[model samples]
Target: MARILLRSGKSPFDPVSPQQVIQQNLIATNTGNLLFGDAVHKMLLTPGTEITPNRYQVDPADADRINDEYDVFVVPLANAFRPSFKRHLNDLSALIERLRIPVVVFGVGGQAGTDYGTDHLAPIEQEVRRFCSAVLERSPSIGVRGEFTEKYLNGLGYSEVDVIGCPSMFMHGRELRVDKRAASLEDTAGLAVNVSYDSGNIPGSVIGNGLINRLADAALERYSDLVYVAQELKDMELLYWGDVSEAAGTSSPAPLTRSHPLLREDRTRLFHDSSTWIDALRERDFAFGTRIHGNVAALLAGTPAVVLCHDSRTLELCRYFDIPHRLVADLADETDLAGLPAQLYEEADFSAMVDGHGERFDRLVSFMDRHGLDHVHKPGGDDGAAFESELETVDLHPGMSSWKGGHDGGLGYRLAWLREADTRSRVRQSASDKRVRELTSRVGSLERQIEESAVLAKELAKANKRLEQLVKEVRSSPYRRLRRFAGRLVRRVRSRS
Candidate 1:
């Protein structure tokens, strides 16, 4: 069996975060980790392949161990080619340099605003080159997200690039069906909305933060049953830990603050896993947002989605997949928000999108095949079906909430709250112990370095002493005195002449 390693943002087996286990439950429910990591794992797993998940931020020292363990290293990166991602990309390049096995990249892309301009990416051109070069040395080609990324690489003189979109789109292979269940969105309909403060507005751009803010505010007002989904750690912190007095003065995103309608009205949510997120979206009427994955989650849930693309990262994927989207630049010019959702669907061709999925799926398969990967969707294969079954057996994460008790209220809530207190105490203690272990390990490494430095210092001291002794001997030697006397005699003879 071939051993494959997956590099991603999160792992399926990561410790249950405080966000995931907000209340005591029979089992800690966390599906957030599965959003990208496990979904890719399922897609890549074949009958003869064994897979392991590792976080993107790898310790350089572990490279040798990884080289010995895995046959191929695969990275599934979403919007990883941005300026913010340069450092991590460089780190991945360093990690790639240490690997002896083949490295295959999946759906990596560059970022600019929805205009697809390359100006913002200029600073990282050399960085991208280094990363691509390292991967090319280990594999035949690098898989890019879409046309913009492919062009981005071509401009850098890298021709061995394939446009495979994203693996997440193939969670169910070519059987994807994203339909607008309701012909029109209504005020009473259940709406799933996602927003972000960071990417919504770029400095010097007229169409960023304000557009998303207006859309969010309009949606909240129009729909009575609405849920706002947040994806980033800061947003998670704001949602769960924002009530503290210290939090008031801290830098929480304005839209996520206690004064914001989403959190203030008890309509905000953060999921620990993809399954739960997708499941939640599956029950909603429509999803629209600045978040690519958030809208993707909605599509995967069989709901219609409208992606508000402020940048190339979201724009490229939405375009490639035929998902409906409006450039934030264009949306900023619109005055009426009441009919935007319906208008977006009317402009989008869902049938065409679904029709072309097979070809795209084949393209993804071809990219995998070129790198010698065995996917679950091969001819006469039940690998894909088997993966779905395996995912079902995985435990679910708890729902999102800050309360000690589960979402349920009353005496049952009190009992759950007591249990939650105990769990939290234990969780804190475990975290403390883990920190101590990490510190001890670091200290041990430092001690060894110090010992090595000490030995080198002693050796340098001995060498210096030997040099001093040699100088002293030369100064006292008979040859040295004779030469000095001869020089003086020559000088006196010259002066007499």
Candidate 2:
């Protein structure tokens, strides 16, 4: 059996508590990463192939172990070409350089403005070059998200780049079907809304113009079964802890805070795993969001979803997958915020995305084949039955909700987690305090040594000054003068002889 090492926070089938997921950042800071990671894991679960999640490690020292244990290293990334991700990209590149096994990268993307300009990516160009070079050394080609990233890498002189969209869209192995159950939005039974809170600060983002939040607010007022799906870690903290510290650096807007109507009314949910997220979305009538994977989760669940394109990454993927979408900037002129969700839902058409999915899936599979990797979607493969069966047996936790609203067993579980977390925090704090005291004592000892050294230095300086004075006085003494006169007289007599 061939062993494959996959880069992911945790396996999709791993049932972890929400607290552990948050503390360890198993979602990799954003829950969206898990969607594609889960997709890649399931897709690569072909017979005779054993897959293991690497826990997102990229240590170069682990290269030897990985090469000895695994036949290949598979990385499924998102917007890793941006500046903020350069350090991680470089680390991964360093690890790949030392590895003797094939390394395959899938759906890596470069983030930029909505105009699809590559200028913003100039800072990370060299990092991108080194990373792609390392991957190409071990594989036939590198897979990218869309046209912009493809063009960006092509301009960087890499010709072996392929546009494979994202693995999350191909999770069902080339078969995708999305049907609109409601003729109009008002007739819909449930609505799932997602938004990128930080996008409100970006220049041309949908949230900046208030379309996403306005629509979410409208949905909150209209739909009783509305769910505001949050993707960021801080949002998850707020949902689970009920209050995120100001130190978390989350910006203003009550909607993102604990006081938001959605959070306050227990309408917000944060999923620690992708399967639960998808399962929840499956029950929704429609899902719309600025978050690509949030809507992708909806699509994966066969729920109709439309992406509100805010930036290049989201726009390109939506275009590549033929996912239904609308530019937030295009709706800036509209004043009727309450009716916009209905209008967007009524206008969305998923025919092309569904019909063309097989071609995209085949493209991804071909990319894998070219790189000497096998996938479940290939001929004679199980098509993810084993992966699905194992996933079904795992008792994965549900989406995390506020503790203030529910009286169910989930609430009890959350309370127990909180109590345990609090106990752990106190123990850690106690250990930290002990360490601090030890450091303080060590610092005091160092300060006393410094004071003693200062005193010795002062005494040495004084002794040196006294020695100089004694030598000067001795040299100026009468006996010294007489000896110098005798020496000169002897030298004069010798010269005369």
Candidate 3:
């Protein structure tokens, strides 16, 4: 077993809560790094080894637990590997530099597509060079995910960079079985639209508006049923808000699917494994996905799929596997799918693409062996098996995958209705604002009139009481005549004075 260091340059805590974030970071110190990087770790790291005794902390002191125990280090990252995190990447760079250990990257993605210069990524690009340059300086080979990533590294003047594609898509050597007369459910066609919150820097309105919907309709034309799948928990919230907000007042049939144990408990719901949703996708004829893993699920199940391309990660994987896809800009209009279902491709025809990916995998393997650590995939590769066991520790129990609504899956017409409702809501809000101002003025005037009337009533009551007392005095006196005399004497006394 090769003692190793696995890396993901993210803080393990929620960004919203400082306390929770602190707790998450603390947990990472105990664990070292996660068992595997998001996509590639599973590819070469094998299934049965502990990557590192301690993980997840950038502070070298916390990571020092394995200063001597580990033989090699594998850093798995996404597109751009900068210190966008709290100095985590820099710290990892320092560790590699000091130990003089071999470091290999597994299909790391995340550079803002190759279209823009590294200058756009700013300080992040600088920091990436700082870390990567040190590793390359030590003679460890580096691998990247796509053309964009490879270009970014080359721009850095690093010579040994290789384009490995994403570990998520293995050039599965097996041929794909395509059902040509693949009939959807009776009377209608079935279309699967996978929703994601992390649009890879995509705008919310883009997903909410006609862009993603147009593709959904294309898939729906040939099917009677359409459904949306969510891989992460937050994705569930996005599907409704993104789709419902757009579909309001509209008769859109965009209902959410539920898994078992629908408790509002903590992180349990969101952490449900990808397997739950993958099994669910097998029931559908075709799936259209924006999330990388969503498409991965489709291929894993041998289902025909189309990548609605957005950013570099999606584009890189789709092209590498020779799968069919469309970009966001292109898919905005119905014209995007000019040939209709012709753009969809079977996952079986990707052997060349898979073979192309082998060089990157080889680099990952080479990095491990260079450090004297044997991955479990190799002849004596115990590390790979142990790595898998670690994943087993994570409960992939996704709550209820099946919830309500089997009959009315088509909500396309309903989405149109929702658009009308949203317009009405805006109109209502304007009307309500005007009504509030009018009613507020009326209330103010009424309050002042009531206050003035109260004062007049108080004065009237005082005068009435005085009159009653005088009448009582006069009436009780046998002395009405005496009162008159007293009044005259008072007048006389005034005149004499």
Candidate 4:
């Protein structure tokens, strides 16, 4: 059996607690990452192929082990060409430089504003080049998220790039069916809403004028059964611990504060695993949000969703997949904000996305074939039956809800919270002690430096005094005066001659 190493925090079947997921950041900072990772993992489970999650490790020292143990290294990424991910890109590049196995990247994208400009990406241009160059050397081509990333890489003088949307959309193989169950959104029973808090904070952003948050607020007020699906680590922290302390000082009208209805009413939830996330969304009538994966999770659950494209990353992916979306910039100018959800639900067209999925899946499989990687969707592979059967046997955790929510205030829940809180407090104290020790060591080094400087100053002072005494002695010598007077006499004789 061929061994495939995947870049993921953990296997999808591995059930981790909310506290450990938060503490270790097993989702790699955003639970959204697991969506694509899990999709790729399921896709690559062909016969005679065994896959293992790498736990997000990119250590160059482990290159030899990987080379000997694994036949291929597959990476599924999201907006990795941004400035914030440059260091990680460089680290991955360094590790890839030493690997002898094939390396393939799936649905990697470049993040920019809604204008799709690459001027802001100049800072990490070299890092991007190095990462792409390393991957291409080991593989036939690199799969990009959409048109913008394809253009960005082509502009950088690379031709070995393909637009494959995202692996998450192809999780169910070639067929994706999304039908509007309710005749209208208002007639729907439940609504799932997701938001990107930072979307409202970015300067010059199309969605920066509180447009995304306002839409979320409208949905919250209009639908009594609305559930806020959060994807960020901080949101998970808030849902698990009910600690709105991070939102304490923020005065922004956006959901940055606990005063928001979601937190106050315990209407927010964060999923530790993607299966549970999709399973929970299965009960919702429709999902709409700025978070791409959040809506993708809804679609995976066979529920219709519309992506609110706030930037180039979301816009490009939605366009590639033919996923229904609306530009937040355009929505900001509309006067009727309350009726926007109904309009979006009515306008969304899922036909093209569903119709073109087979071709896209074929393209993705072709890309994998060119790189010598096998997938479960290929001929003679069982179409992920084994992966599906394995998933069915694992008992995954449910979505994390607020501590104050219904049935969550029970004694068992409170005990778990207390234990987790105590563990967190101990971690904080340990961190504090570590910081104090560091400061004490720094202070000791500074004192030693000061003492050395003082000793050096005294030595210099003694040397200066000795030099002054020697100079005074030389001036006071009579033989020295006679030599000077003779020299003056010789000069007067020469002038006369």
Candidate number with greatest TM-score: 4
lDDT of 1 by residue, 139-245 (tens): 99999889999998999999999999877777777788987676777788888877756663333344435667777777788789988887666455445554432
Off by over 4 Å in 1: 9-15, 19-34, 200-207, 244-253, 402-497
Candidates 2 and 3 compared: the better one by lDDT is 2
Q: TM-score for model 2?
A: 0.80
- lDDT: worst 10-residue window of model 1: 24-33
Instruction: Write candidate 4's Cα lDDT for 1-497 as tens digits.
Output: 98999999899889888888888888888889999999999988877787899888789999999999999899999989888887899999999999999999999998887888778789899999999999989998999999999999999999999889899998888878887887887743688888887753223466656777787787778888888888888777666655433334433456544557787777888897888898899899888988999999999898989998878889998999889998887786777776787888889889988888889999988988887877887778888889889899898888787766456546544554575688689999999999999999999999999999999999999999999999989987998899889999999999999
Poorest stretch of ten by lDDT in candidate 4: 243-252
Please write out the lDDT profile of model 3 over residues 1-497, one tens digit for every residue: 55566665232221222233233442232111221243334444554444542335556554355456765566665544533452767787767667645666666665443133345456676677877787677555676766766777787777777666655454221223334235323324444566543344433224445455445445544444655554443333322223333223333332332121111111112222333445565665676667566666666556667676666666776675566676665555557442344455433244553354455456545644664544454665553344445555654434333222236564533553464478579899999999999999999999999999999899999999999998988877868878888999999999999
lDDT of 2 by residue, 56-122 (tens): 8779998889989999999999988888888999999999999999999989988877888777678
Tell me the whole-model lDDT of each prediction, alpha carbons only: 0.75, 0.84, 0.52, 0.85
| Candidate 2: regions farther than 4 A off | 200-206, 244-254, 405-497
Better of 1 and 4 by lDDT: 4
RMSD of each: 8.1, 7.6, 18.9, 5.5
Q: Which should have the higher TM-score, number 1 or number 2?
A: 2
> After superposition, which runs of candidate 3 have C-alpha atoms over 4 Å from their true positions?
8-48, 52-56, 82-88, 94-101, 113-119, 137-139, 171-191, 196-210, 217-224, 236-271, 335-373, 379-395, 399-497
The residue pairs found clashing in candidate 1 are 29-396, 29-397, 29-398, 30-397, 31-272, 31-273, 31-274, 32-272, 32-273, 201-209
For candidate 3, report its TM-score.
Answer: 0.57
Model 4: clashing residue pairs? none
Q: Report residue 461 deviation for candidate 2 (angstroms).
A: 27
TM-score of each: 0.76, 0.80, 0.57, 0.81
